[model samples]
Target chain A: MKPAIKRIIFIVILVGLWELGSRLGLWTELILPSPTSVFTALYHGFADKTLIWDLIASFRRLAIGLTLALIIGTSIGILIAKSKTADDTIGSMLLALQSVPSIVWLPLAIMWFGLNDKAVIFVVILGGTFVMALNIRTGIKNVSPLYIRAAQTMGSKGIDLFIRVIFPASIPYVVTGSRLAWAFAWRALMAGELLSTGPGLGYTLSYASDFGNMSLVIGVIIIIGIIGSIVDQLIFQRIEKSVANRWGL
Target chain B: MFISINQLNKQFLDKNDQPTTVLKDIELDIEKGEFVSILGPSGCGKSTLLSIVAGLTSATNGEILVEDKKITKPGKDRGMVFQEAALFPWINVIENVMFPLKKEMSKQEATAQAKKYLQMVQLSNYLEHYPHELSGGMQQRVSIARALAMDPEILLMDEPFGALDEQTRTRLHGQLEEIWIKTKKTVLFVTHSISESIKLSDRIIVMGTRPGTILTDIKVDIPRPRREHKEDMLELEEHVMSYLKKEIDKVVSEELNHETSH
Candidate 1:
């Protein structure tokens, strides 16, 4: 068998075994729900207005946080890239902070902003912005001197130079950074929802687990994974591949 | 008044707080509609000299005037073609050609102008092709077209065809000669290729390294659109080689010695 086919069949067999084992009474249906039961749970989630509200709440937080990160990070990146003083001051700090996980900020975030969605948004921004800044700065700095020289020769200077040459040339790297940031932010949001327990997918998971409805918990976990993957594959991955992979810049 | 470079000097600071001269007290005058080539070996600072003249870098001590205006900085009067094509990958061929003009003209005007220059380069069919999509020769043609579209007072090229294959380079030589005759633009082209210097340049400035300076300024009296490898071309090639071979050998052996010592 082809390697890809073999891998697919192996995964199918594993999932099938899990389903069959639960059905055969090796584990209770409450703890390890059948795939059918989880699919039903997913259906029930969409059948109400509550799930919509949860999604809106989560999305709104993600939107606000990510947007702020984009603006601030991009500005910081440009500064660091353009100035040696800025790099000396902030570059090391950024490196240190990026190494420190966003989850590590949760306790402090709770202390500062409380358990509201603001705290979650704050965490997301903290998770996302540094990655974007570092990548943008790196991309800008790595730009070929030849390109800049050519642009100068063509009478491109100042904003014209940046807009025409620097930004477009650095876009592929920016997209890569953004994809990485989105993953970090999304995972952070999920963890935030799980811990904070206000509303959203994470809340739903905790609520199901609290109620000892393990099947619903399993269902929520699958839903989160699917949503994350879909967003990555459909949106960020597509953009990254289009800009970075195809060009090989 | 097309271009004048007076007492051009450039210095670089070495690792030990010592200043090293790259180009020395050079004086050059380029009249309107002249084609000049600077010839030198790798470390001879010919590229540095060209870059300084083009206003890509500041001359440590000198003045460059394009059309009687002191060129302390880069301007539209000078259009430069890099050693690499250096076309922005995101933009298509036409867009790359149109870039210098887009800020001045309307989209329609820029498009027309871009199309005109692309046509000159025989790249009208590849207008929508991205930089990576085009062959190296095609990309360099686009680069030339991009510079030509600017309609600058002078064209500055830094070994622009160095990376190309010999056949493609020869083809480009012919195309470039045709374009030069058609446009009559002042050109200051830099190259290490002796045949290329003889073929393209009206005047050749041979340079020497180790505090780089002009060694000789030999005029090629050949007519435009001359055959590249004919007996006369070979004789001129020999003349250039006679000057450059010793310098090239010295630089190569010095480099090898340095590497071995390291």
Candidate 2:
């Protein structure tokens, strides 16, 4: 079977099994909401504009958080890549810091920014920045030394060298770093929204669960996964494919 | 002298901190618009010597002079082409050829100069093609155009055709010879192939390995359109090969000793 067909079949089987189990009363409705009820909840949520509002709110945070992460991460990465002393000292610190989960920053972010947008954004930054910096550093370091030498001989120097040669040559790696950073930012936003009280999918999830609206909870979860997949497919994957084509990757 | 190397020596510390000399007491004077090839065995530091002359690498004890000025760093006076084309993959053929020219000339002038060189290399059809889209031979030709577009006083090529097949190599040799004659730029070429050296060079500088030093500097007196001088070319090839064989044997024996001892 074609891969797309296989995927559709698998999803169908999964939904079929869930529907069968619900019909058989194998589990409580609260534990596992029926797919039909979840769909109904989704339709009602869309009609009331609650789901769209929540999605917009989450996307707004993601846009801001991601922009900040990219700037800070790329700068730190370039600094680390260019300086041997910085690579040796700060590189090790970053490696250690990256091991801590994004959720681990929740307490500190709350303490620093007191349960506001700042707290959520702070957590998102902590999640994405290190990963981006580390990947960018690797990308810059891995740029072919031959390219540098060739460009140098051609009268390229200093800032010109970095901009014309280093930056373009490291495109594949930098794009990959951005993709990973976006993923990290998205996850951090969801985790932060759960605790900080925001108008987002995470906020809706927490609210629905608290009210024992299992169908709404399930509907929101599906929407989150769908949104993530859509962005990856439409944006990040498109960029990666074009880069691969250009570089003959 | 248009370009001169004086008492040049290069040494490096091995992993154990022992001194390892790569090139020693290299001295040569190159006239303006001369085609010179440095021929040697694999480890003979031929490329190193070329790099030092190009000011990409520094000599341990001496200095190089171009037009009576010391070469402390790479300048527009010298253009270099490596074994690999090393063209910027991000840019198209015309852009890459135009890159070095951009600093000195306006965009239109640079593009026109680039177009002329590309046409000289017979790559006018590929002016918009990316480096990756071109074959190895085509890529090397683009690099030649890029170097020529700079209008440097000297061209330093370190085995520029080393990676291509025999057919492509021969064709490039013809193209390079034609370019050299037309441009009349001083060139310092490095290669291991005696035939390649004999075909294009006005003078061949043969070198030996293990503390690389000049073995002989042979002048190719066998006039231009050398296709008519096949017999003379063969005799020079044999003479160059005779000296190169001793160096190759020494390297082989050393490698065998290393393996046996290990």
Candidate 3:
């Protein structure tokens, strides 16, 4: 069977098993909602337009945070890659900072920016930027020295060298870094929304849990996974594949 | 003299901070439009000499001058072709050829110039092809076209055909010879192949290993269309190989000694 079809079948089997377990009372509906109940909740969310608003709100936060992270992360990465002193000083500090879980920044972000969009965005940027910077640094480092030498001989120097040779060659790594940054930003956004007052999926999920709306909570969780997968499969994965194809990697 | 190297020496500091000499007291005078081959075994520093001349590396001591002007860094006047084609994988063949020209010419002119060189290298049909899509020989040809498109006064090739198969190498030899004849650029080719040196070079500088220095410089007086003069070429090849064999043995013995010491 084709891999796509096989994957669909696997998902169907999982849903079927879940539905059967719920029907058999293996788990109470309060604890584990049936697939049908989850779907009904999902349908009602769309009918009421609340789910769309939540999605828009969550995506808005992600876009602002991710853009900021990419800008800061890429610059830091290039700086670390270009200078030995920066690599030793700022680079080591970043490595140490990366070890701290991004969630740990939530309290600090809240304290600094308070319970507003700024707080969530700050947390998202904090979560995403370090991993992106590290990946971009690695990408720059791993570019073959031969390419640099070749470019130099072709009359490229300084900024020309970076733009023409180093940047293009390191694109695959940068794309990979973006994907990881998105994942981190997504996780951080959720944590932020859960704690702060917001109209995002995380906020709705916490509300549902508090009100004992099990199906709504389950539906929101599925939406998070779906959105993450959609971005991965549709955008980043395609970019990676095209790059690999072009470079014959 | 067009390109002159006087009392050139290069050394490197090993991990132990001991100075290891790679080239010593190298002197050469190359005329305008001359095709010179630096022939030597592995570790003979022939490539290093070529790199220094190309202004890609600086000699620890001594100087190189082109038309009496000192060379300190890589410039458009001197172009280098590496053993590995080193073509940009992200760009197409025509773009790779046009890369050096972009700074000097408009996009249209660069395209036209690149096309002319690609045609000269018989790769006009593969203009849009990416580097990885082409065969190794074809890729090297693109690199040659790239270098040629620069229209440099000197072309420094460090074993450009070294990685190709025998058949590809032989065919490229003919193409390279023809290009040399047509362009009349002062060519400095580094190679280990004796026949390739005799087949193309106006002068072959045989080098010795272990603090690399020239052993002899033999001028090839054999006329062009060398394929018609196989017997004469073979005789010259034998003469070059005889000198090279001694250097090869010295390298082998050095390797064996190092291994035993280890």
Candidate 4:
């Protein structure tokens, strides 16, 4: 059978099993809501426009945070790659900071920016920046010296060399960095949103859980997982593959 | 002399931080439109000499002058082709050729110049093909086209065909010879292959290892389309090999000694 068809069948079987267990009273409806009820909650949430607002708000924060992270991360990455002092100082600091989970910064971010979008965005930027910076640094550093010498002999120097040779050669790394940053930022967003009062997937998930609306909680969790996979597999993975193919990395 | 190296010296600190001389008292000169090859075995610093002349490496002492002007850094007047093609993998054939011309000409003019050289190298059909898509010989051809597109006063090539199979190397020799004849560009070619130096050069400067110095500077008077002078080419190849044999022996013994010592 076709792989797509096989996957569909597998999903159907899993959902059928879950529905059967729910009907058989294997557990309370509050603990293990049937897939139908979860889908219904999803439908109602979208119909009420709450899910739409939540998605918009979540995406807006993500876009802003990721953009800022990429710009700042790339700049710092270049600095670390090029300068010995920066590599020894800020580079080491970044390596250390990358180990700290993004959610661990929630208390500090909340204290600094209050329980607002700014706090969540701050956490998201932190989540993405260190990994992006490290990847970019590695990317630039790993550019073959042969290419640099070739460019130098061709009358390329300074900014021209970086833009034409180094940057393009390091594109495979940048693509990888962006993919990792997206994942990190996505996780950070969810964690930060849990404490946030604003309209967001995490906020709604928490609200549903607190109100014992197990179906709504399950629906929101499914939405988060689907969005995460869709963005990664559809967008970032495609970009990475094309870059590797073209660059022969 | 169009290009001259006067008492050029290069020293590198070895693993123990002791300065080891790589090239010592390397003096040579080349006339305009002359094809000169620096022939040596590995560790002979022939590539270093070429790199210094290309202004990609600094000489520890003395200097290289192009058209009577001392050169300290890489310039548009001197173009270098490394052993590896070193074409930008991200760019297509035409774009790689146009790279050096970006600051010198408009986009359309640069494209025209790039296309012209790509045609000269017989890669006009592969203009949009990325470097990764091309074979090794084709990649080297693209690099040669890229270097030629700049219209430099001197062309510096460091064993540009060294990595290729023998058949491909022989084929490229013909193409390179044709290109040289058509352009009459002053060429400084470096190679380990004795026949390659004899096959393509107006003069071959055979180098000795261990503080690399010129062993002999032999001029090839063999007629153009040198294939017609196979006997003459073989005679000179043997002559060049005689000068390199001692150096090659020295390198071999040094390796053997190091291994046994370990």
Candidate 5:
């Protein structure tokens, strides 16, 4: 059978089993809501435009945070890559900071920015920046020495050399960095949104749980997983593959 | 002399921080539009000499002068082709050729100029092909085209065909010879292959290892196309080989000594 067909059949069997268990009163609806009720809750949430608002709010924060992270991270990466003093000092600091989970900074971020979108975005930026910086640093450092020498002999120097040779050569690393940053930022966003009083997927999931609406909570969880996979597999993975093919990395 | 080297010396600090001489008192001169080859064994520092001339490496003592101007660093007037081609993997064939020209001319002009040189190296059809997509020989050709496109006063090639297979190397020799004849750029070619130096150069400077210095500088009186004069080519090749054989033997004995000591 085709892989897609097989996957559909597998999903059907799992959903059928869940529905059968629910009908047989094998478990409380609060603990294990049937797939149908979850889907119905998803439909109602979308119909009332709550899910739409939540998605927009989450994506907006993600866009702003990710953009800021990339710009700042790339600059820091280049600085640490080029300067010995910076590499010894700032590079070591970034390495230390990278190991700390993004959620660990939530208390500090909330204290600084209050319970708002700014707090969530702050956490998101922190989540993405260190990894991006490290990846960009590695990317620049790993560029072939031959290419630099070749460029030098061709009259390239300073900023011009960086832009023309070093930056372009390090693109594979940059792509990888962005992909990682996106995943990190996404996770941070959810964690940050949980504490913030906002219209977001994380906020709604928490609200549903608080009200004991198990169907809504399950539906939101499914939506989050689906969106995460779709963005990573469909967008970032495709970009990475094309870059590898083009650059022969 | 169009290009002159005066008492060039280079020393590198070994792992023990002990100074080790790589090149010593390497005095040489080349006239305008002359094809000169520096022939040596693997560790002879011939590439070092070429790098110094290209201004990619600094000489510990003395200096190199092009048109009586001291060369402190790499410049557009001198183009270098590395052993591995070193074409940027991110760029296509035409872009690689146009890279050096970007500072010198407008985009349209650079494109046209790049096209002209790419044609000279017979890679016009592969203009859009990325460096990774091309064969080793083809990549080297793109590098040569890139160097030629810059229209430098001197071309310094460091064993440009050293990595290629025998058949590909022979084919490229023909192509390189034709390009040299057509452009007449003052060429400083470095190679380990004795016949390659003899085939392509107007003069051959044979170098010896262990504090690398010029062993001999022989003028090739053989006329172009050199393949027609096989006997003369063989005679010159044998003469070059004999000079390098002693150096090779010395290296082998040294290696054996080191191994036994270990």
Candidate 6:
């Protein structure tokens, strides 16, 4: 068999063992629901259609947060990289901001914006922007000085130089930063949902746990895992490999 | 005249904040279409001198004149070919060559001119190839072609073939000679290799390190298309090597004596 197929089979076997263990009463149903029971709950999740709405709402907010983070973060990153004064003053502030956990800001966001989309958006931006800016600054700063000199010799100056040279060179790092920020934002989203109690996967998971619906909680957990893996495998991982492998990053 | 460097000197403050001179009082005059090589050992400030001519680095003192005007910055008039063949990796061979032309020409015109220059280098077939895809020698050729495409009056080469293997270097030396003969641009080449300096230069400037100064400035007193393995070439090569050997020995012993005394 192919190695990839073998790996898949190995994972399936481990999951099968967990299911068997749960069914054989190694733990209570409350502790470890069987795979079949989880699947059943997931099916009921689809039947309700509220779960879909929750997913769409969360994904929409995520898109806004990520978009805002990209524009603001990259701009700041470029500024900090280009100017010594900017780097000294703002770069230190960015470093300090990055060290603070996103969860710590939830109450502040809620206080400022209330329990709506803005609060979640605020959390996502706070969680993501520091990583993006810091990585991008580092990336732009690391561009070979010789490369810049060569470009300058060719009469490339001002905006044209940045567009043709600096932007392309720094893209691999920006992509990497976005990928890292995605994982951070994902965690932040869950924490925010749990506390804020809106209609999202995290909120639904919390609601299920509050109601003692272990099966529903298990179903939400599976959904989150599947979606996270899909995003990593299909989106960010492909971008990283394309840059580092094919483009000689 | 093409360019003139009048008493050029470059200095930097050392760690102890003492002024340390790299090149000292360089005075050189180049007529139009002359090929001169600035030959030196490492740390002799040959590259720094070239950079000063190219206006990529400040001279720290004195003036460089291109066509009787002071060279305060890089312009289209003076093109440069670096040691590492600093081609833009993002652009293909043709685009790399056309980079300088973009400021003055339309995109289509720039591309046609780029192709023409590539053809001059016999690299028309490799127009689509990226810098990394080309061999080291080929990449350096692309750098030359890129500079040539600018239609500059002078070519400042800082050890352009210094990184290639023996066979590739020899072949490129011949090719460069042919190109220089055909184009007739004022050229200033920096090289550590004695034979390379002898082969390509109309005049050779041997610089000594540690507050670098011109040790010798000798005209080749030989014709172009000089071969490497010839008997006559070997005689002249030996003369240069022996001369450099004595100077190097003097330098080494002085440093050793200084060390022992300290």
TM-score of chain A for the candidates in order shown? 0.90, 0.96, 0.96, 0.98, 0.97, 0.94
TM-score of 1: 0.93
- A7-105 in candidate 4: lDDT tens per residue? 999999999999999999998798889998999999999999999999999999999999999988899999999999999999999989999999898
Give one clash count per candidate, in the order shown: 0, 0, 0, 0, 0, 0
Model 2, B1-262: lDDT tens per residue?
9988888999988999998999999889999999999999898899889888877788888888899999888877788999999998889999999989878999999999999999999999998899889999999999988888989989999999999999999999999999999999999999999999999999999999998999989999999889889999999989989999999999999999999999
DockQ-based class of model 3: medium
What does candidate 1's lDDT look like per residue over B36-74, in tens digits? 999998888999888887777888988888767887788
On a 0 to 100 scale, what is the lDDT of residue A100 in model 6? 93
Q: What is model 4's C-alpha RMSD?
A: 1.5
DockQ-wise, the better of 1 and 2 is: 1
lDDT of 5 at A129: 96
Which docking band does candidate 4 fall into?
high
Candidate 5 residue lDDT tens string, A1-249: 999899999989999999999999999898989998999999999999999999999999999999999999999999999998999999999989999988888888879888889999999999999999999999999999999999999999999999999999999999999999999999999988887777999999999999999999999999999999999999999999989887777
Write down the C-alpha DockQ for each prediction. 0.70, 0.67, 0.69, 0.82, 0.79, 0.54
> DockQ: which is higher, 2 or 4?
4
| Top model number, DockQ | 4
lDDT (Cα atoms) of all candidates against the true structure: 0.86, 0.91, 0.92, 0.93, 0.93, 0.85
Fill in the DockQ of model 1: 0.70
lDDT by residue for model 6 (A1-249), tens: 999899899989988998889978999888878888888888888888988988987788788887888778888999999999999999999999999988789899999999887898889888888899999999898877777777777777789888888887777888899998887788778778878867888899999999988988988988888888889889999989867753455
* Candidate 4 structure, TM-score to reference: 0.97
Candidate rank order under TM-score = 3, 2, 4, 5, 6, 1
- Measured against the true structure, the TM-scores of the candidates, in listed sequence, are 0.93, 0.97, 0.98, 0.97, 0.96, 0.94
Best-to-worst ranking by DockQ: 4, 5, 1, 3, 2, 6
Residue-wise C-alpha lDDT for candidate 4, range B1-262, written one tens digit per residue: 8888899999999999999999999989899999999999999999988888888889899988888899999988888899999999888899999999999799999999999999998999999998989999999999999999999988999999989998898999999999999999999999998999999999999999888999999999999889999999999888888898999999999999999999
Model 4 ranges with Cα > 4 A deviation: A1-6
